[model samples]
Target chain A: MKSTEILNSLQVSLTIKRLCHQLIENHHNFSKSVLIGLQPNGIFLANRLKSNLEISIQDEVQTGSLDITFFRDDFRRKEKPLIPSVTNIDFSIENKKVILVDDVFFTGRTVRSALDAIMTFGRPLSVEFLTLIERRFVQNIPIKADYIGKSIDTIKEEKVSVLWKETNGKDQILLYSPT
Target chain B: MKELSTSHLLGIKDLTKNDIQIIFSTADSFKEVINRPIKKVPTLRDVTIANLFFENSTRTKLSFELAQKRLSADIINFSASSSSLNKGETLVDTANNILSMKVDMLIMRHPHSGAASFLANKTKTVIINAGDGTHEHPTQALLDTFSIREKLGSIKEKKVVLIGDIKHSRVALSNIFALQKLGAEVMVCGPTTLIPKYMSELGVKISHNIEKALKWCDVANMLRIQLERQQIQYFPSLREYTHQFQLNKTLLDKVDKPITILHPGPINRGVEITSEIADSEHSIILNQVENGVAVRMAIIYLLAGSINRV
Candidate 1:
């Protein structure tokens, strides 16, 4: 596969700082809002944003990790079994604004699943989407992100990957294509 | 740990230690999901599962149904009493008729041993043996071991005594197979008629004395006397059986250290176990019921997953 480093480590940090600032500009103290990180991949970006947001807002924002494995529309289409991760949201989301976070915004399927999943907790006052990379011109659902880190045009076969320091010992986003 | 090699979960004998570990961890995640405000997952929304019970059951059937619902799968429940089995239709015919509707999986409970295995071979759909005669209730055993591991933290080197009717109790048979495979020492304590001699060949010790068994073991898994499956009286009377093997607070106090108690309900209160012990802190009966849903979900999810991996 051929790959290009779209965002260097330093640029990634700056983009995250800017995203945190933009999040604070709208949500303020975030006392009425909670952040939910989509499981498996979104968790890395969610954790980084959650920790960074706390530093900017100077208050604790209830952050949780949710696994949409069971909620996916195509969950059982393939024979390969999907291993479900733990959905750890100990607090109630009733009447609070929820920000569903993920790494890449491609088909909008994960966000769709997250939307159905969040209802089990309680009815939220409102729900919003936040994604790190909004890959341009690819959406199977009528869904868009409220917070986006970067938008880039890409082909159908190309893959966008976000690496974090906590999990992969680096902070970068790469776009990979078939050689 | 290795994933289960077989797509169908007919019995504990088909699972390895690693398979149990994988199921336990998967159930652990499910347990977390059930505790959340939103108890449902969309994973099995595209799949349809049928719970086919040819035998009478309350807990297992409900548990499997609840697990299926939680996974957001389409569910159909069939029982012998409500179905056309009274018209003399064979089990295979009934199953194939249901499968013709495009059901993706079948969970069954029957009065004969290997009944699930028999159907598994006849159908391409995934078959899970909820309980099959005196053979093995794999899910119950999985939940039992899961409950034990959850309570005591581990089963390795732990002494578990299966008390009461062992001959006809499918739970006891499955538990023995699963626990032993996971490195736990197992013993059967009951009357001579109830505790078969061939059980010793399976590598489990036999004990007729309940007091000795309780004192020696770290966990006592009390089993009900299945009077329904008995053709003749296995024991003389219930009073005599209770006198010999009943577990109350007095028997529990006799042990030097506190031992965890497990009973796959509906409990024969005051017979195999007294009300005092069944409701005590040492008993994980309710926990077992709660884990039942999670374990069933794991089994269904994993089996469904195996189909695609192939």
Candidate 2:
């Protein structure tokens, strides 16, 4: 296996800051909008974005984590059972702008499932998605990221991994492929 | 990432501690889902489940049905009284007939022990035993233990006493298996005639005294006196049994330390426990019912996941 570094520690911090600024530009005070991080992989980036946004706007940012495990189309199709993460959106999302965040945007299945999962909380005004790493040309669904940190042209055999300082002891994004 | 070791939820005895923890954590997730503004998930929308109850039940039936609905699974309920069982159709025939309709899973409650096990061998669909004679009600035990862990923080090292008719109570047997597996000490306290002789052999202590039993434990689980299952008189009379074993406020007050109380209902209002005790802050009976849906959801969600094995 070959590993290629896509973004380094400095690049990750800058990209997150850039994403936060873009989010602030659109959502303004964020009172009418809530940032929801997809569970497991997306929560790390979500938490970082929340803290950064709060520091910039000098106000509380409503953020929650949503698990799409149960909502996934492959729920019972995998070789092993899909274990779910906690869905902790305590506040209702009724008619509020929802910015769904995740680490890597892959087959668009996660976003599709998230769309279904988020509806159970309540009907949102408009839902937009944000991702740090968007791999282009392989999306099986029509879903696309509204705010992207980086977009890379990739193939099916190669994998993009986003490592977090919060969980992985370092911040970086790496692309893996067979040599 | 974690699948149940077995595809079917037959009994607590067949589940490992990891399986129990998995179910508890999954139930915790479902617990949050059910409390949300819209109490539903689209997880099982593609799956279909048939609840086959060969015995009469109120709480278990409703709880299982509610859990199934919350998961958005297509559901069909079968009643023994209304079914072709009157013509002496075998349990397998009845199950196969239902499975023919492309039912993905089967949740059943039969009056005979090992009925789920028997059907599991005969069919390929996932099976969950709601209750099987005096054998085991796995989901009830899961919800009961879940409620205890919810109220007490943990089940480890907790002293839980099962009080009342142990011989005819499937909940008691499943509770003993589940509690002991999770590192909780269990004791059965009731009339000796109603308490089975096997209770002592199972490493569960037996006590004839309710006050001493209550005082000796951290949680007291009151089992309803099952009159329907009792063919012969297990004790002299209901009045005598109540006078001897019914738990009221006075009995609770004498215990010194407050012990959490659980009763798997259709609680006999005054026969096994008083209405005060049933409705008191010390009681988590309603929580047991509420958790039943979550736990059953976890059980069904875990078992119903993955159709290739079927």
RMSD of each: 2.1, 1.3
Model 1 residue runs over 4 Å out of place are: B1-3, B306-310
DockQ of candidate 2, scored on C-alphas against the true complex (2 decimals)? 0.69
Task: Tell me the number of clashing residue pairs for each predicted model.
Answer: 11, 2
lDDT of 2 by residue, B1-310 (tens): 3667888888999999999999999999999989988898888888889999999999999999999999999999999999899999998999999999999999999999999999999998889999999999999999999999999999999999999999999999999999999999999999989887778889998999999999899999999988898889888889999998999989888887899999998889999999998999999999999999999999899888756543
Which one wins on DockQ?
2
lDDT of 1 by residue, A124-153 (tens): 999999888998889989999999989999
TM-score attained by chain A of model 1: 0.96
> Can you give the lDDT of residue B122 in candidate 1?
87
- TM-score (chain B) for model 1? 0.98
Q: For each candidate, what's the DockQ? A: 0.50, 0.69
Q: Give lDDT: candidate 2, residue B122.
A: 98
Interface Cα RMSD for all candidates?
3.4, 2.1
User: lDDT score, residue A14, model 2?
Assistant: 98
Residue pairs in candidate 2 whose N, alpha carbon or C atoms collide under 3 angstroms:
A76-B306, A83-B1
